[model samples]
Target chain A: MIKTFLQHELKAFWRARNTGKNVAVKIIMGVFILYLLLCALSAGFFLDKILEHAFPGQNIVIAFCGIILIYFIFDLISRMQLQELPTLKVQPYLQLPVKRNALAGYLAATSIISTFNIIPFILFVPFIIKVIAVGSGAGVAWAFVGSVFGITIFNNYLALYIKRKANLNGWIFLIATGILVLICLGDFLWHIYSIKDISYLFFGHLISLPALVLLPFLLAVGMFYLNFLYLKDNLYLEELNSKKASHKSSTEYPFLNRFGTTGDLAANEIKLILRNKRPNSAIKMSVLFLFYGLIFYNKPAMMHTDYPVVFVGMFMTGIFIINYGQFMFSWQAAHFDGLLVNKIKFNDFLKAKYLLFTLVSTLAFILTIPYVYFGWRVLIIHFVMYLWNLGVNTTIILYFANRNSRRIDLSKGAAFNWEGVGGTQWLISLPLFITPILVYLPFSLLHYRDLGLAVLGAAGLVMILIRSTLINKLEADFYKRKYTIAEGFRNK
Target chain B: MITISNLKKIYNNVLVVNVPQLEIAKGESVGLVGNNGAGKTTLFRMILDLIRPESGEVISNGEAVAGHENWKNYTASYLDEGFLIDYLTPEEYFYFIGGLHQQTQAHVDDFLSTLTDFFNGEILKKGKYIRDLSKGNQSKVGIASCLLQKPELLMLDEPFANIDPSTQIRLKNMLKSINKQHGVTTLISSHDLSHITDVCDRILLMEKGRIIKDIATNSSTLAELEDYFAVGQSVISSLQIDEEENH
Candidate 1:
């Protein structure tokens, strides 16, 4: 039965009823794998740089390990594709004499079948290839191979776990933050015991290879178990297919009667995000800004003052906000018809989105509070960023996002060559990421920290100030192309 | 249940839809029949307030629907699976719509009990996400949702397009019963004349953005209505024969 199911999945992929772009993405990833392979082969020339420490060859293993770890991060980050897991749209097949276990097993196994991990095999294996062949048994080589497979499956499950957790509650993030806190504070606690660098003991040591071997295996098992549990829990029709975004309109919401009924609409949008996938992603995206400061936190001088590079870095990520905002209209694309038929006010509709933006960016602004402690100047810059994002990027993205044609499968993970991102998005990103650099670079060239900071600040402020006009421009632009955008999104 | 007046929706300087005064009274079942781009959907949407009329507005319950706050509380529609929020199972979706108007799940379950034959049994127990369901099954879920809501106004466009024939008949009967039982006003659009004829009281045949014929299907036989649409009248046909013989 398992074999039959596996064969079916393989056939299904070949004849998958997915878009051309999805197939094309698989091909594109193949190219990426090739490039990664070539990079590894080129790096093989420096194999002798290996044993600088007692664990001289450890760095290569670490490099290989890093590859595994980072891919896991990317997998989790790109939660859209793998997060909810591909719902078995073909579950009707369950009644067609197919064993339930077979169907479930097929899904569980297919989770590990991706081409993303091919690069590590090409890079890491060759480093140990000669060493294993000459001395250790092929069992060692087999372990390396086994470990790699384990990594792939483990990461797949980790991503799935995070996604499932995220779908359920906010505690996943709280837990993740808690974990990060523990990692950072571990050294401080270890120092109190005058202990060794913790990371070096388990991960860096060779004997710990068994744990590494078990890591991926355990994760894969855990994930399969999760998949099984999810299926078991949601096997009923009502539980499986219901849109879960429903919540009682809390009468106590102070803002409810302000916009009157539209206030409820605004309140629903908040619930839509909180109860839906986007808000979690939006929160994750917001927290990502805090991680940026962490990346620079380790730098001594960089923390003391606002560095142009970091400022550009901070402002460069302004595109993410735009990216988030791009789907402003499309998210509601499904209900566009309802919005029309019900005679709902378009102004209220637009106002609900704007209100939604205010709510999100405010959350993001609060999330970025940590930057203030980085420096007083960072505060001014991010504040300008907040306004600029509200004023400029919000309009810019809504305008172009109003133009983006692809239908975003909100249920799918938004990572790793996912669809709905288009050429228009690229154009939007260019100005958001680069334009800030142009403003910052000129000031940096003149050797003025405050001036460069001012340039960034002023640009954001100007965008905020002209927001109304810009929004008007976007509205006009949207009105012009609304039909085409609407039509394209529903299909894609 | 619904009315549209002087509705003109211009797109790129073109008069895409120009619907002039339409009144659908309480519990009336109306079918909007239009050829491709005859402005049937645009008219429905304008009435629904999904799109603004460049010139006019739609009124519901003697009030402009466009300005009302709780129009949706009593208005349940499924334009397509998009409105279905495919993540939810059929039962979940029904309960959600049911819940929205302050109905309980047991109420919805009781309402759904009448439509057991239509469900074809067992998929409802599968907890299948609406996205995972087949198009026909999805339509069943959608139709069941609108009916379960017991909305005073239900607008369903192309509801029968992708459904299987058996389910189509079930849906036709379901819509009929719902309209009769609740006095729910329904505006359904479909290219399938037969399905419309089976359910609708009045069929508004639209061509080139105007209602060219308002056939009282309840009063007239399907054959006569078909002939009226074909424009193959006795005189027009005889003239065509003479012209053909001359050619």
Candidate 2:
């Protein structure tokens, strides 16, 4: 029965309407995975030397043991974000003669085949063989490997269980992520407890007493049983479909009522982003990227150079414009005909898009205010980028948006689902990223960094002042291609 | 109030809509009858300026619709599900449309009171998004939205196709009264000959992207249309047989 189920999945994948595109994406993903595996393998081979250099005079085995725990913690967080639960696919088999346990077991088993599972083995197996086996007996080395495998499987099932629960109640997802973030902060920032010391105490014991490996092995079995039982009890169609008992309340933007038609349109666009799956995910990702400056700005070496700061500032302030604007028109491809025939001016429509971009980029800029901890210069650069994103990048995004005729389905999941991407998305990035850089590069090359900042800021201010003229031109461009866009939308 | 001169649309070297000349007068309820792929929807799209013509143009109220926005001020159309913003509830969608035509919430409420029977108690206050509604209910929402604007011209494609039998009758009566009372210029395309003949003053028969027959809806109009379609059925059957044999 599991074999039959697997066969059906294979056929469904191959027979999908976007099979040709999916094949191309799969090839790219395959090459990417292979490249990552190669990097991990080489890193594993040199782990002993790296550890020796980092912790001079410390036991290399103890250092390796301490690092493994930290790696797993981060691995667990990534799995929580990226792993997809296959529960929905089991709906068809619920009514069949197959046992519920088997179906649940199959689901849990299939998730273990993920790249997350393989990548760790590629990264750590070599370290175990080269360092542990040569130092300790083969039995202890194999025991350590078994414990690693057990922990990997344990994280896989644990992530699946939490994600399934999160699907039913969004608070679960928030709480889980919150706890993980708190743990990371407590370890990295506060230094209240040393994770390295705790890891060394636990994993270092496994090297001498192979019996300690049973801890993870038993935990893996316990998690798998819990998942299997949960699935069995909640296999009903209604529970699987929408388990929530509360009705969703509607939101009212009372302040927006003042702007009349343009405000109404912008409000509708906001509701679209909040309510739909794909756009909602895009908005969530933008929120996640808000903290992106921490990764770059925290490094003392990075602060000396202005280019990286500029790049980070532009990305932090204008993330929404780049992420959401790429699908500006295609977002409404489902109803383009209705918009074209409506009693609204093309100019008003363009104005509404510009207003929306300004609103979001402004909000993003306000959110990045904390980045000023780095310096007031950082804040100034962000303000300029925000202006450029509002005045210049918005127009660029909308203009290129007109050229993209592909339709995007709003209900599909955003992860790895490239339904609407095309060559235009790639082409638009060049001007958006390069134009500002070109303006900055010449002045920066001459060591006139302040002048470079002023030039970028001036251009952005100029674009904002003449935005109405730019809108008129974009409106004309839209009229020229509305039919082709409509035709493309209708074909899908 | 609408004129099409030398209008044409082609897709991949195949002509989809080709009309040398056509005219619709003010307050004229026109019915377009055609089979699948007969360019009925295409013609309506062109009239609304949702699609551009290969040559010539659609002039609505003496203004060419392609580059002008004036026609939409008094024109309303619903061609398919594409016309609906499926994420909004029916009431929200109606209010949004009403707001576009400058109608206030209270005014929209008063107007919606007249559509209570047309809504059949399933659409308004249903607490469901338009996408979640049944197809028949969605059609009612679309038709109701089109009427909410109180436009000088209105267009609907296959309004009777997905609606229930009883609502179809009520809708036919509603359309007839709206046209009579307000002198609204209405254009509707449908496969139901009886409904079209009962509601429209003039019927245009289309075949293969061409208007084959134009007749006022008289007492015998339905019978004449049936005879033409019966002959068309025989020709289609014979062509299918020939293709099968050739293959």
Candidate with the greatest TM-score versus the true structure? 2
lDDT over C-alpha atoms for residue A20 of model 2: 76
Best by lDDT: 2
Q: What tens-digit string does per-residue lDDT give for candidate 1 at A68-151?
A: 443444444443332335434435565688766666565555665544445456545665565543445565556656666676
Position A52, candidate 2: lDDT: 97
Query: Candidate 2: global Cα-lDDT?
Result: 0.81
- Which interface RMSD values do the candidates have, in the order shown? 8.7, 3.6
CA lDDT of every candidate: 0.61, 0.81
Instruction: State the lDDT at A473 in candidate 2.
Output: 91
What digit string (tens of lDDT, one per residue) describes model 2 on residues B112-220?
9999998989898767777667889999998998999998998999999888999999999988987999999999999999999999999999876788888999999
Worst 10 residues of 2 chain B by lDDT: B238-247
Which 10 consecutive positions of candidate 2 chain A have the poorest summed lDDT?
A415-424
Docking class of 2: acceptable
Chain B TM-score for all candidates, comma-separated: 0.86, 0.95
lDDT of 1: 0.61
Q: How do all models score by TM-score?
A: 0.62, 0.83
- What is the C-alpha lDDT profile of model 2 across A1-492, one tens digit per residue? 778888888987797645775677677767867887888888888888989999999989999999987888888898887665563266567787989888877776777777778877887788899989999989888888998889988998888788767655555666787798888888888898878888888788998899999998999999988988886776674443432323434456777788788877877788778766667756766787798898789888988868887887788888888888887888887777888888877787788888788888898899999888999999999998888788788888988888877677663333223343332244347678888899899999999999999888888899999999998899889888888888767655
